[model samples]
Target: MRWALVGLVTFVLFFPVLAAFFILLPFDRDRKHIHPLISFWAKAVLTVCPLIKVRLEGAEHLKQNGTYVLVANHQSIGDIIAILHLSHSFKFVAKEDLFWIPCLGWALWLAGYIPLVRGDRMSGKRAVDQASGYLKRGVSVLLFPEGTRSPSGEIQAFKVGAFKLAAEVGVPIVPIVIHGTRDFLPKGSRLLARRVQVTVKVGIPQQLAAKNNGSVESFSDQIREEMIQSLKSIRSQFKTGELVSV
Candidate 1:
């Protein structure tokens, strides 16, 4: 019943907003207009679906006008919804197939998010190049460094693309960690849990060293490890019931 209600609400709100997005596209260069609309849509979805509770931490770390190569660990589809709560303007590097979905995909295209075809070498390079272009133009780009959601909800091996792009464009890498979303909407299932608490922690933005001899692969590893540690800390607080919602 809850899932059905959520779906109805999503469709009802999505169509009209998508129409508005289409009309704005010709004048919406840099996607400055589209992203905020998407953010509001996400917030409204979360509001109507009371079963999911999202708690955000370290929001103070984000600067209003700052540009970043935002990186996060993916757990489930709900991760994107949780991220939308951040209310920050950024373009996503998403899988190619997602761009084919009806309303959602159209919105992604209108928002100017980059698409990546899995396991295709040229596609990988193109995604990096497009993302780099956005970063160069002072727009933040968000990427899931693991490339896909971890089936076991564990931190998977990091891909070098995000780190490489950040290194090349001289942008700060902001690490974000999300937990409890998998419980709300696990992989390969559409049934929503009655109640679940999701937490997102935004780490301080770190810039690559100007003279570092380490490869981008190594830097990716370092960031992944930091995210692992942050996830562990969030889990501990969850168990202790000490988390204060933001």
Candidate 2:
């Protein structure tokens, strides 16, 4: 299968790079430069996968060192790699499984990513506690409110964890819509032997801007509604096969 080949190649080429990256953790004087390197590595591997073409829009909307939370729609396995390529120095919460994922886990930890057990609320609590540190350092934390990939490739209702973190840390929320990965290499698929184009739209950044903690929950609810609107605006076009760059 094409996926089998792709997986083989991923491990063959990536393992060494990952090992080197992991080994550099304690000695690496600079963490900022490392994320781009990892992102670039992923971008380069994905290019050779022969199944996807990635594009980004509204990059200018991002502000450097902006402390915030990012929530995006989940589509496919490739979604992870694509976002890493597009996001620079952004630390997002991920499942604890990633920590045991050989070299990738080590690098992720060194980069300040928070990990949760996912199934356990206690893990969420720990992750939230850790996220507060990231916010204080002015790092961007990505969240997929749906908590899991959508089986139907359509939008799923989002959870409140990201908003809770935002409220706890008092940071802005950046809503993003990622289009097209589900078709290329969706859930339970293998080998991207053909090329498919994917687009990432960076929407208007929604600020929490709440006057009090009591309003945090409501404010984040509004922010979620805005993100849903932003994603829906683009969803129709993608579904209709009229997707264009931007």
lDDT of each: 0.84, 0.71
* Error at 183, model 1, angstroms: 0.9
lDDT of 1 by residue, 41-155 (tens): 7777787786887888998888877889999999988888788778778999989988897667777887788899999999988988888888888889999988898889999
TM-score of each: 0.90, 0.80
> Per-residue lDDT for 3-70 in model 2, tens only?
67667766675665566666776776345556776676677667666667787887767787566788
Best by lDDT: 1
Model 2, CA-based lDDT: 0.71
Each candidate's number of clashing pairs is: 0, 2
**lDDT score, candidate 1:** 0.84
Model 2 misplaced stretches (Cα beyond 4 Å): 1-30, 99-110, 188-194, 210-214, 238-246
